[model samples]
Target: MRADRLVSLVLLLRRRGRLSATTLARELEVSTRTVLRDIEALSAAGVPVYAERGRHGGFELLPGFRTELTGLNHDEALALLVAGSRRGAQVFGLGSALASAMLKVVDALPESYRDTAAGAVERLLIDPETDLLSRRLDAEDLPDTIVGEVRRAVFAGHKLRIHYEAVGQAPKWRTVDPIGLVTVREQGYLLAARSGADRTYRLSRILAAEELAEPAQRPDRVDLGRAWQERSVQFRTGGDPVTVVVRVNPNRREELVGTAVALLAEEADADGWLRLTVTFQDSRHAEWALWQLSTNAEALSPQGLRAGLRDRATAIASRYATP
Candidate 1:
């Protein structure tokens, strides 16, 4: 472990010259005393590392000391730099690792492209937490301790006990065989098996995790992408859904379509509107979506839906009626 830390220390110093011991300690997640000892070790190993004695002074390598192990070309280095700037690395609790790796990637670039690559990342924004309508996207907060345990369990092939709070359900502790962790649209999910049935748990909902020493009952090799696809298909098709036919203004068709679970059919109306048969998660969902669109969208089928809408509109109309 110290060996890896020493190597990271060297890489940090090599990439970012003249780093203060305090800065090194913060970046390395250690103390200044440890940083001083590491510097002494590097110097003893003939690394030509030296310290300066004043306010603006810090540890820096002597001139002309360089490692020839870098091999990334311009475009390759730029791609890595850009990817390293994304939210996935931080969302998965690998922000520090990604930062260190990007430093190496930038340092590996040719001198002519290094600054350009670094500057190019500044112009790109990936996975902002809010949309154009100012709605907060799903960027759930995952505790570092819980995530670390889940990650360990997934990697070590160990059974994990987690305190999970499913939506609308009380928190409960579950013992699961961790298959893998998946991230979609910035949310993290742990794909595991519970009682030999496929289970998916949102990482944010995991209040705590304990990695058991007993090996998990899972195959040695897993295709997480395929597994995720299968789980997604099951989720999309399993719910008790309600189908509704709706006639919507041509301009607001997309708004109505966005809320449906599935689009069954669509046609152009004689009045230049769009008639569509779509499915929603349930009647409540169906009523709410059309209600939101007001006059722009009309639910044409499923008599229950139209009645529900009629009752709601009548109530609203009575409340605001001319008196």
Candidate 2:
């Protein structure tokens, strides 16, 4: 572990040119004394590290000294830099770690490829808070302490006690064996088993979490992709779903089908539109999704949904007419 810390310290100095022991201590998450010891170790090992005295001076590497870490090609370096630019890791409380790792990755690249890769990354913007439609993409609000506890339980194979607040339900405490943590669409989830029955909890909804001393009751090896897919299928089908039959333009069929949980049946109409029977999470979901298409989509069955759309349209028309 000290070796790893020494390597990190060298990379930090190599990238930053010079940094104070206080800065190195903070960056390495170690005390200044540890940093001093590591610096001495590096010097005694024939590394070209030298110290400076007084304010605005600390440690610097001798000029032209480079680590033998030039393995990344141009595209590979670009990929890592671009990935580091995204805020997805913030949800998992790994943002700072990702940043530090990225710094090491960039510093490890061959000098010839470094500036070009960094410049290319600067030209691209990813996951900006606001998009062209003025719609904002905000990070999830997950307490770092809660995420850290759940993460530890999942990694250490320990059972966990969590206070969860499911939608339309009171907050209650549950002990579960955590299978894994997942982030989808900027939302975090914990896939676990309670009494050997699979369950999922959103990290944002976890009011509190405690790692238990007992070992978790889970398989030694887990295929996260398979587990997530299985749970997703169960969640979609198990909910109280609302079915709708609609006639939509052929061009918009994919959009309609995408918004629905499943497409039960499809028929092509003479007017170049599609007759689709679909299932949604609920009536409100069906109405809201279809409403986005305006008149391009029409509810054929479920008179209640059609009436609801009509009422909404009437309200809109009345407001415009009044002007």
Candidate 3:
């Protein structure tokens, strides 16, 4: 815990410039004395951290201290700049600083590398329609901490104890033999072996984690990447497939099929309407599709699904009806 706090304090100082011992203590939930001790330890470790004593003074880095990066190529440099720019936009009080730092790095690059960097920056684009900031699945949004542990365990061939909350299930503590971590759809997941069985746990759902003293023996032929791909396939396949036929107005036909859910087939009627046969994982998908289509599409399928849609539509229509 002390080590974790110390590391967090270092990162906080790096990101926020400087803070007083009292402020650091509050942020780390430690005593002021502990913060002072940590500062001393950091200074001993050649961090160049120092305290300023005065009404308007706190703690600050020794003058001329700077973070240095190495081994970055032209494309890599541009990619870093683009990423920093995007993050700066999302985070308040950070954009201008990040942009300025990126500019310094770009300006320092040789002329031979500048054109490549510029081209890479122009090609790096993010879709504004997509939600960049997603809701946190776990109570504590400590992805970096979780990821760091996973990487260490995987490298050391160690076991881990994790408190996890599975979807629709109560939180429970479990022991896992660390294998590898996977990133899917902007979420980090752990592919670990528990009780001789391989399983994937979303890192976001991990409440807490700790490394075990004894390392577990990894399988000789463990293919971490393949395991993640197989698990993804299984997840997508487990959902109950439901077929729904919808009649959409010709003008709205393209919109109806352009949804995220997989579409099976579509046929146009002579009267300028389209009949689409689509298969979705669950009723939620069907509901979303109907919502997107609004009045232009009608569900025609298994009696139960059709009736449910009709009921929902009736309720929604009644809300806007004349009193």
Candidate with maximal TM-score: 2
How do all the candidates rank in terms of lDDT, highest first?
A: 2, 1, 3
Residue-wise C-alpha lDDT for candidate 1, range 286-323, written one tens digit per residue: 99999999999888899999999999999999999988
Per the 3 Å backbone cut-off, how many clashing residue pairs does candidate 1 have? 0
Instruction: Please identify which of the two predictions, 2 or 3, would achieve the higher TM-score against the true structure.
Output: 2
Return the TM-score for candidate 3, rounded to 2 decimals: 0.55
RMSD of each: 14.8, 13.8, 18.2
Q: In model 2, what is the error at residue 319, expressed in angstroms?
A: 5.9
On lDDT, the candidate that comes out on top is: 2
In candidate 2, the residue pairs with backbone N, CA or C atoms under 3 Å apart (3 or more residues apart, or in different chains) clash, namely none
Q: TM-scores of all models?
A: 0.71, 0.73, 0.55
Query: Residue 76 in model 2: shift from native, Å?
Result: 2.8
Task: Give the Å shift of residue 308 in candidate 1.
Answer: 2.9
The model with the greater TM-score, 1 or 2, is: 2
User: What's the C-alpha lDDT at position 80 in model 1?
Assistant: 85
Per-residue alpha-carbon lDDT of candidate 2 for residues 1-323, written as tens digits (9 for 90 to 100): 78767888888988888899999999999999999999999999999999988888999999999877445678878988999987778888888899999999988888899899999998999878888999877568989999999999999999999999999999999999999988876788899999999999989999999999999999998998999999887876665788999999888888888888899999888988889999988888889989988888999879999999999999999989964
